[model samples]
Target: MSDEVIPETTGLRYFDEWLIKKFLFSHIEKRIAEQSIKKYGASPIYLSERSQSISSLSEICKRRGILTGLGDLDFLQNCSLTQQHGARSGFVVLGQTFDKNLGEALQHHAQLIESGSIQFGSPDTEQQIAKFVEGIISPFKDESSRLKVCEDQALDFLSTAWDLCRSLIRQAPGYEPKN
Candidate 1:
């Protein structure tokens, strides 16, 4: 999405830089680090989109000795899952998006996770994230669930974003229930 502020919201609907840094940064980075350490090894493995934003944070992480220091995408080529070094990058940044776009982003990201294409060296990483996505998108299929999971996670959302996210979820891959 453009950097333009959303018309109705007087700000970008998903644009909450403060919250992103204060909450999402530590929350998700820790998750990635924890999974890499617990499941694989106590090695640094940062991951994100191919952009300056991630690269900048990654550099910070590396300088602080938080990770092995991979702000570039070259790490994906190395067959060193056994040897921890640089970070892996994905096309999407799930936790940083706006509430309106999150459901759809989660849906797309979930496919990558489930298909085993987005391996982060953690066996259950994909499953763990997929379950989280399922909860956020379930309201699209069953409105009764509402925003319980989001609220539980201390995520602030917009009412309009909820509807938009639900609609996006409906259009995401595997939106159809098998049952």
Candidate 2:
């Protein structure tokens, strides 16, 4: 809500950056790329070339001390999904916080996966992530099952996310925020 971090762990919690990166972001990106290539004739060659170019450029910058690659923390700080981008030149960087109830649900899901009760990317996990996104944009109604994000908040979040994605697209091997 406010820019301040929630003092109580039960109030709001940031998702684990590593988990978000590995399980959420990376998976989503790959899925999108695959779908795009299949349905829209997106060029894998372009993606490969771009990735290679970025890697090479990043290495050079790292050696020159002009670049320090973005880490999970950097994403948490700089591309926090919690805030609106507004007219900001850079991505809204803050800790992406969500309701604690959702956090608990995700933890339970993780435990289920660990015990092999559910498989990652299964329909179960897909539904879980869908609900997770719903929870992100909206407040939990009746144990976090209902999507209730206000229009303004939803717009803000989408715009902010778009900006963050753009920034990420422009990011190199070692991305240093200009701001």
Candidate 3:
């Protein structure tokens, strides 16, 4: 698919710095440390200590006005997420944009869920998916069911993207993309 055809919302700009950070913390950093140790016989302790020292220095530079910490943090965090997604630097830009779009989409979906238009779960299900969706869209109305539609749509989009990536990787050799 052409780059433009991949909805800007589906790429990576939809994610914010904080969400990217959470993604990295949840998925990437530890894997990178593990890989480094396995490939180079590097000591995790030394690697972690150096990483911490570099991070501290970066913070100091940021505080001293030598660098914009926000940009650095965003770059580092996004880099990690992109790496985890097996996306290249160009794709990282796309992924960051997609992440931003995803955040906006989620916010919009949440609004719908809170409105009560999207109910799917029930007290018996114990899943609370319906209730969670309702809570997200509730601000629009004290009682509504329209939000469920939007939530389902968002979930579908995420599912499709996951499937597409899996298919693409399976079709290509040496498919891993570097950050």
Candidate 4:
């Protein structure tokens, strides 16, 4: 289902922009690293086999499950993982190209992502994000309570980040935007 195409809407358009920005940042980072190595005659950095295997470019995301499904397991003599465990066993990798506050919030949820406890569009995910915003906005407030984040403020934050990232990418030395 990852290959399935979803039509663009207001929400999806934003999603697409976010994804493209992530890919662009990674591409530019790699290019810059390569240039630095060439200019300084420094040794190239090598990635581990596992890290190299997980290429973001290879993962085509669609409107599908946040976790990957386990393939046929009838061949196993004794399977220890139950259906529930199998359902949430997959991991979704996220790239960091935004503010530290966002990165810290994501870091807090990294465990949940790895554990398959949080799904896309889940209330838990929203709650986490809200909590993160609350922490930044109202550090003195009680952590036990949930703070309602203004929708407009959230959207504005994202828009500003998107604009800033685009501006920085354009200013990147020798960076050329594709036609």
Candidate 5:
């Protein structure tokens, strides 16, 4: 137990990010202690591999009996985790980077839906994301209730757009011609 200090803003290594996604059970202190384990790297991973073990990356995401996607699971598992778990999992401030929030959240939700394409996999992974993210951030219900919250939002936007289109058709000057 060296009295050394590890900062929180540091990005997670590859292996730590993977365990948190696959197991969804890693605590920051847990990884540090596991590093000391002799004879093996990490469970399902050996400590010798350190954080970024490409060989140890799982091709699938197994969560609560659900599996997602078949290709390399590296970026999805390793990148967004620190974003999801953040400082509690480590002094990890950034894991993966995206251009914006709504897009990033939507992309995550989409991938989740993609993952559920297999049998016994969840079909409403997107429905769970809002409550899932909110659970960590605010006073939304502790669990997700239904799927239409997302659908309703999309419908609302479309409805508004349709109304605007109709109004413009009636209001625009009809005699104008383009050269």
Candidate 6:
């Protein structure tokens, strides 16, 4: 008899197990790479260009009598930025933009929480994380506090994921963290 291992479930793909294991093993590395790029500055030129293009589009839209809301303007600007600089540059620019947005959102949520405008635990996990950072940063009453809180959160998230992966690799057979 052949010694080949076959999946017990018929509907699953042939390599589903390998794929799942691979994803779990590499997820931490992916997070680290993302955090590192954000922290160490991967491509500032791309971001600068993206921001400039967005501003230009907003100006053009304004001059053309287009009644674009801020969200629409922002979306169009991002599209233009991405188109001009290619997908990779666009990805980095958008990633940083998202990070900034999260920080702002957190601050806003924190304000709502402080003012009793919103109930605690009502919002999703992302909203909660943002609110938490906002609260921690609020006490300092300076721009640096917000920056510090964001940086701390980013690092903490990355480190925690990495440590978890290490633990999993130690406990599971055929599981290895990617370099």
Q: Best TM-score goes to which candidate?
A: 5
Error at 4, model 1, angstroms:
18
User: Which lDDT values do the candidates have, in the order given?
Assistant: 0.40, 0.40, 0.43, 0.40, 0.41, 0.41
Residues 94-168, model 1: lDDT tens digits:
333333323232233232111213346788878867866776665233323433554544444576678899899
lDDT: which candidate is best? 3
Instruction: State model 1's lDDT.
Output: 0.40
1-179 per-residue lDDT for model 4 (tens digits): 11133233345422233333333343344445568689987635543322221222233335762322111111110121222123443322233434443333233323311121335587589877766676667653542232234355568899999999999999999998999
Ranking by TM-score: 5, 6, 4, 3, 2, 1
Could you tell me every candidate's TM-score relative to the true structure? 0.18, 0.18, 0.21, 0.23, 0.25, 0.24
- Clashing residue pairs in candidate 6 are none
Off by over 4 Å in 5: 1-6, 9-146, 175-179
Give residue 64's error in model 3 in angstroms. Answer: 45
Please estimate how well model 2 matches the true structure, expressed as its whole-model Cα lDDT: 0.40
Q: What is candidate 3's CA lDDT for residue 47? A: 32
- Residue by residue across 17-87, what tens digits does model 5's lDDT show? 33444322222233554664543654443323222232233223335644343223445443553344432
lDDT of 6 by residue, 60-132 (tens): 2436655333453334334333232333231322312354433332222222122213346664766766766
Candidate 6 has an lDDT of 0.41
CA displacement after TM-score superposition, residue 113 of candidate 3 (Å): 17
Per-residue C-alpha lDDT of model 3 across residues 52-149, encoded as one tens digit per residue: 32232223243554532345444444444433333322232222333443333222222111123333464445446656565665543432243465
Worst 10 residues of 4 by lDDT: 69-78
